[model samples]
Target: MMKSLTHRRLAELADVYGGLFHLKMGQLHMVAVSTPEMARQVLQTQDNLFSNRPATVAISYLTYDRADMAFAHYGPFWRHMRKICVTKVFSRKRAESWASVREEIDSFMKNVDARIGSSINIGEMVLGLTRDITYRAAFGSISEEGREEFLKIMQEFSKLFGEFNVVDFMPWLGWISYQGGNLHKRLDRARGSLDVFIDKIIDDHLEKKRNKKNNEGFDGLEEDMVDELMEFYDENGGTSNLGSAVGITRDNIKALIMDVMFGGTETVASAIEWAMAELMKSWDDLNKLQQELADVVGLDRKVHESDLDKLTYLKCVVKETLRLHPPIPLLLHEAATDTVVDGFKIPKRARVMINSWAIGRDKNAWDEPNVFKPSRFLEGGAPDFKGSNFEFIPFGSGRRSCPGMQLGLYALELTVANLCHCFNWTLPDGMKPYELDMNDVFGLTAPRAVPLVAIPSRRLT
Candidate 1:
């Protein structure tokens, strides 16, 4: 896996060995699924048997022993956490309630507007926007010092989490491997930094609740996620409605907060950055999208959430971007029971990776699979990233699909539309559109290998 790019290597191997191939990485038995039919078999047909997560050192440490929803094993606890997240935190009403999204976008656009006619790192700006919005939505309002510290910790944590630790494959040799790589030491440092800040956040939230200040709780008309979690803790006596057998602890709160911060920030930022990069490379598509935005949302006003649904071309651009560069290219899963997928035996405890990147580029499933063509999505009977269509699932399918899909799309589409609507972008220093580097820096989420620096001039509506 280290000799070549992980996703591409997996895809090449899948082609040779067929869509579904099994391999042994040390003591680990791994299955890589690269085609839509095989994806459906694992993600939809036998989702339950493969719903468990294979714990890694960094993820386990960061997620408070897999107490968070994303990496938790498939069982009652996972179901409970998923229920709370879906119903309380990530519900449509909850996502809409964050009026701060508009405020943050306004600030973002103003910053971009201020830099008109000059080069700006659009990727960096997009990352900042997503980070600010995620922080404000989670902790209500945080001090600058706190925000900086939290963001730094999160950035390090994300890098560490995405690293391929040798210990993950060969657990018994972990002690010897740590001496050479210090992976354990790094994980401890990142986890410790995160724990300090998150603990402070939870403590502050509890203190605010004790003081009974109405103005301090909600960001605007709605309670932030922490406030909601606190309410749940109080109402249920620190236990989830799942039962007293399993309870929400301070660790649980911190874990969920970590999930929200990491999930909300990086994935949306990556999508927007990739979308911008792709658009810069495809000027015709960019013009078409901008034209759609102009017809729907005049230049006198900024693009609003309400305007997003009507910007059909913009949606197609986003879908195309995601299809080519999914935030999470490989969906990780662990087998909970022995099962047969396409006549092959999948033993319990086997690690399963659904190669979303490969599936999206499958020549059998898509026409000109490598092309950056948003019109493919605009055609009749087009596929979407709603987890229903295996061929185009930027978000994974079945029970363990991304819970924040709606909120993520909202952020991605809104940011891209506003940027395209407000300005006509060109590569910096008179660079041609075809000269832009499209290489990706892979991690838990893949971002552009080169930061997208472009000059933006305000467009006439």
Candidate 2:
């Protein structure tokens, strides 16, 4: 399983065994859950006990020793961080307030226009678009040199996050990974690069705050995520009742910002890329979606966020795309304590892998599970992805569910809508729609195995 795609392999095993099965690998106790009922048992029924993440060596190092909310041990501090994320960072109001999103999208449109007649890598394009939006939102203004360097580091971070480390599974073989210091050296370099970049951001923010205090008419800069976090970092001498046992530190702030960047960028881009890929392969669905966008958004103007709700078909396409290609196929969680789930014994500290990709295609749950039919969702009584519908949680459910879901979904919907509404896309090099490769490369997120390349022609005047 370690040698191949873990989720696909686990799903294959589930087919022969059952929806739920256990495997003991070396010192690790592993359990794979593929059915909705079993998923509910773990994600909802025993959510608290299974809420904690099982961080690998890379995860712990990249996440600053579990300081970030995504991998933090489920506790008061996690709850506090989640509260801030909900109320401040990923809040609906904050998402709505982000003009940077529109600016970035407009810039992306301009880039797309520049190469309309030629083949372009849609996946790479969307990746850069989301990266810029995330950077601007998280840190207001930055040099392109800094942004590009940080992006390279983040790519390394993502690669390492999914890299195999023998130490995580068999602690007794710890020396194997450290024999050459290759993995440790990479982890140190990645985290060190982040520190240099983010530490300078923190210092700059502090200097600006100081200047504002000293100067009666100091030029105020718009607050970015760093500014927002500094309020908590400086609260009550850094000991605010934000739910932590101790005061927040620079590491905490940096970790939280990393969470925002990681959560926001590639995940959204991956979803958008998949949506485009699916649409490119299915012309009838593509035409229907484009028609809906045309009717609601109109060709004369770009699709706005306010116009999104009216573009129902566009939403359905997104749902169908996520159903087929969930950004994270395997939802990783660890058992906090020993307990029984669905009449089966679950040991404490056991690794629970929820095969959401398989669950999405469960024949019992979906009609023609392999088909990409957006109308399945357009019909009444469709399961929504907002946690209640276990059969359709592209974003997982319960406490460990994605907090930035609203923002990410907004980005996906808006980008897809604009891309489809403004342009007519076709496979490059005279390639047929059926020839477009939909196979994905699994990692932190499963993006396309081959980057999507297509030609665009303006559909609107």
Candidate 3:
């Protein structure tokens, strides 16, 4: 098997061998599902059977033994965590209460405006904005040094999570591979750093709770996620309401914090970077989107969340970017019991990988699968990112679909729209539009191999 560019290789293999195929990775039985029909069966029809996550060394060690919602086994604990995230963290009300998103974007645009006329790294700028916004949303306000350190740790965690360890596939060779590659040491170091950072944040939250308790009349303050989760912890008598379950512990809170930090930051940043890369290459689409923006939002003002709905073309561009470059190209699942999918027998504990990248590019599902056309989504019967349309699921479908979908889309659309609306972007050094490098560095999220450096001139009213 070709180890590098594994997702693309899987797409090519699926093209030759049809939608469903089986392979063996050491002692692991693996199934690759690429087409929409197969996706429906695994994600919707037999979702329960394939709902559990396959344990990986990096994920298990970094995420507190799969205590996080994303990697937790499909069971009561998962349900409990998912409920907390949906209701307390990512609820529509909670998303709306974070007015800091707008404030952060304003700061971002000011930084961009300051660098006008000179080439700037748009990828880095987008990453900075997302990281700041996510940090603020997760833990109110953080110092510059704290934010920088947290971002560094998250980067290392993402890199280590995506790494391929031989011990994952062949356990018998664990001692040799673990000692020779220092995989255990690396995982331990990353996990330890993250735990310490999150622990401090949690302690701060506890202190704030104590202060809030002391205050008699303090209704003006807004509760962040930690406050909400802490409230739940206090209300439930320090026990998770899920019967007979070990209550939500400090470790669980830290694990969920890890999820929010990594999930909210990396994926949204990658989407924005990819969208900019695509628009940079496709001039017509860029112009069309700008025209829509001008018509919807005048030149005197910045793009607001309220204005996003009227700018349909901008939404389509985001959808198109997601289709071409899904953050997580392959969604992971594990079979909980022996089952048959598309007439192929899948054994219990088999690892299932749904190649969303291939599904988006499937010839039968999309016309000109390789093209970067946003109009496809503007047609009368076009699909959406809500996961109902299997062919267009940038976020996975069914039970384990991303709980942060609404918040993520809000961030992606807002950032992309403002960048396109406020400035006319040009490649640095007069490079041709089509010459932009679209190569991707694959990991937990696939970001551009080359950071996008472009010149931005404020658009005239």
Candidate 4:
């Protein structure tokens, strides 16, 4: 069966891993699992111990040893940091504060229109748009100023990290990747960028504070997560030391920004790419979708946030993308304390992999499991993504799940709808449609094995 594993080509994983099993990635023990009950029990029931994040040596070193929110476990400090995001930053009031998001959307459209009549790098382009949104929303800076330098450095770091890092499995050989000082060079670049961007933002905050310019007002930027993090940073004496008077550091806030920056950007871009690939695979699906878009949003206008409800078919396409190529396929949830499930003991600090990719296509859950059919979601039929059905979790469910589901969905809907409504895409240079490879080269975000290459012809608009 192990030998046949490679021969069968390792398609859907739920059928392969079953509930739990040990697979070897060299010396490391790789575990894969399926089922909503199991996921809930591990990530929710034992939320305390099981909410730990699998360590990131690269980011840990960058953050001066695991001070980042995404890398931190469930604890008082993490709680304090997360509150800044949940309450201060991403709160309804703050979201309203950043009304410029629509302006950014307009900027995105203008940029896309510039690429008309030419083959464009949609993947790279999407990253820039996401970065600009995040930078403005987080630090009130575009990704082009000194802050943009930090965004670019982190992007390079993530690109390298998205690759299979052999050192992750063999920590002893971590030096192999940095024999030429590559790791230090990247970390240095990131630190330099952070020094400039975050420092400038913080300085601006202090200046605003000195002038008392809306610093204490209800609608002021003080209610922002960045502002909260800075407040905590100042109260705590500028250190992430344990048992401090305040809570966390400025670096922790920046780390959270990086989390949204990477987690939010790559997945959104990949989802857009996957949606395009799947839609192209089925012309009938595209035409059906186009009719829906045309009815809801005529050719004279473009799809906006308000138009998302009418474009339900396009949403189905996004769901299927999550099914086939979930950005965080092996949703990482580390064990915080030892716990037992189904009479089996999971030791503390064990890495748990919710095989969402495999679960999405489980034959028991989906008909024609291997095929792409956006119509399956036409009715209220299959399990919704909330972990209720457990079969499809493009965004991992439970307490530690992605908090940016709405934001990610917004990017996905607007981008996919606009692309679909804006252009008729095709494989470039006479490439046969059937020859396109859909295989995935798994990464931090599972992306298409071959970059989805296509030409975009703008609509008559």
Where does model 3 exceed 4 Å of error? 2-5, 95-97, 142-145, 177-181, 216-222, 234-241, 244-246
lDDT per residue (tens digit) for residues 1-461 in model 2: 47433778888888898988999877889999998888988889889899999998888988888878899989887887788778777777774326778889989998998898899999999999999988888887633458888888888888888787778878888777454279899999999999999888888888877887898444646667777777777433243554554456788888888888888998899999999999999999999998888788778988887998888888899999999898789999999999999889999999999989999999999999989999999788999998988887778999999988878888889899999988999897789999988887777788889999999999887
| Candidate 2 global CA lDDT score | 0.85
lDDT of 4 by residue, 1-461 (tens): 23322212333444565566545654554455666556666656666666777765565665546566667777766666566666665565665424545666678877878776676666667667766666666666322366546666777768545434456666677668553266667667766676667666677766665656654542344233466566666534434554444455566656776776776777777887788888877778888888888889988887777889877888788887778777777787776667776667776656777767766766766888778888888866656776555677878866567766776777777878887887777777777767778877666777777777677777746
TM-score of each: 0.94, 0.95, 0.95, 0.85
Comparing 2 and 3 by lDDT, which wins?
2
With a 3 Å backbone cut-off (N, CA, C), the pairs that clash in candidate 1 are: none
| Candidate 3 colliding pairs | 240-247
The better-scoring model by TM-score among 1 and 4 is 1
Q: How many clashes in candidate 4?
A: 2
Give the per-residue lDDT of model 3 (tens digit) for 138-220.
77753335888988888888788877777778878877954536877888888889788877877877777777688844435
> Which runs of model 2 end up more than 4 angstroms from their true locations?
95-97, 142-145, 177-180, 215-220, 234-246
Root-mean-square deviation of candidate 1: 2.5
Least lDDT summed over 10 consecutive residues: which range in candidate 4? 1-10
Clashing pairs in 4: 49-336, 49-337
Model 1: per-residue Cα lDDT over 341-369, one tens digit each: 99999998999988999999999999999
Models sorted by lDDT, best on top: 2, 3, 1, 4
lDDT of 4: 0.67
